[model samples]
Target: MTIKAVVFDFGGVLIDWSPEYVYRQLIPDEAERRWFLTHVCAMDWVVRQDGGQPIAEGTAELIAKFPEHEVLIRAFYERWQEMIGGVLDEGAATVEKLDAAGVPLFGLTNWSAETFPYAWETFPILRRFKDIVVSGRVKLVKPDPAIFHEMASRIEPHLPGIEPHEIVFIDDNRKNADAAAALGWHGVHHTSAAATEARLRELGLPV
Candidate 1:
């Protein structure tokens, strides 16, 4: 089947998000900042929150391990909006084109349930999506086939009888893109808005 829909990954693709965005100001020294984020508030540890653990609970767990960094740990979730710079204009424009072309657009993102609302409020472009599957809400993260399947199944309500292979998935992570391809979906390893839009165009998408 020809690609009939586009599935997007939020951070790094459509919107910019990074612990560094928050930590840089808090922990001025680059080395200490990297150490704090890696050893204390690791992405692996943070992903548990993305997998549905409450942000407060996740922070407490980290605080237990690194009590000295309690305030920094708290800031991870408390000021997460600082991590999001804004929407990527290139990606946003592509989405707008796809939306205007009447293509079904959906989102699959590994965002904290507690913090995702901030993104929803901060970025108006996200509202264009027909549906969004948040990892925190669903307890599933990308590079896991289950989340991809979940997105596929959920989108059925809007685009009935749609096949996974007929959807084009775009993500900044190569592993996530690989996982989507494993399911026979056309995967676009997004690097920049221009490159991603080119890939979408190559896939015969409206963008």
Candidate 2:
């Protein structure tokens, strides 16, 4: 298969982000943190923000529903930066190798519009992408074919006449990777940095 450029999914693929990072400090008790994440600040609710819901609105809605855990709910977004540990070591290293090899890298991420700026500001790796299509800014989250198409559109300008099959997409989420595959884009499920690098090499990419 002829490949044009490789697209990367941000959070799990490159950045080490999780609510657990901050919650471990705030909640203290593992069991209670688990319950709170499961019952209150569920991933679905968090994902809504990723798809463009205002942070204030999301936090307020959750706070209203679970007034008993108001402090915990508020801390979800208020301390959003704390949830990020840093760039994944292997992933960052892999990106650097790819960059040096002149691979065309691009980003497609399900990140909140409000919070994505901080990452963009801090991580030089993210700046390596020729362009990035952020879910929150466009109101289109992944696993939805529309967002993948949006990525394709953004990529067209840099690598003209590129077809879906010519692009390789790497994502940590199997579902999102599968979605890209369904659209005829080659999908690499990023389980580990080593695995992702190997997969890209198999695809004839520089990495």
After superposition, which runs of candidate 1 have C-alpha atoms over 4 Å from their true positions?
Answer: none
Q: What digit string (tens of lDDT, one per residue) describes model 2 on residues 75-181?
A: 88889999998999889888888888887889999999999999999898898899999999999899999999999999998889998889999999999999999
lDDT of each: 0.89, 0.91
lDDT tens digits, residue span 1-207, model 1:
478789999999889888888888899999999898888888899889899998778878889988988899999888887888898888898899999999989999998888889899989999999999999999999889999999998788887888877899999999999999999999889988888888777778777
Q: Pick the candidate with the highest TM-score.
A: 2
Error at 160, model 2, angstroms: 1.2
What root-mean-square deviation over C-alphas does model 1 reach?
Answer: 1.2
TM-score of each: 0.96, 0.97
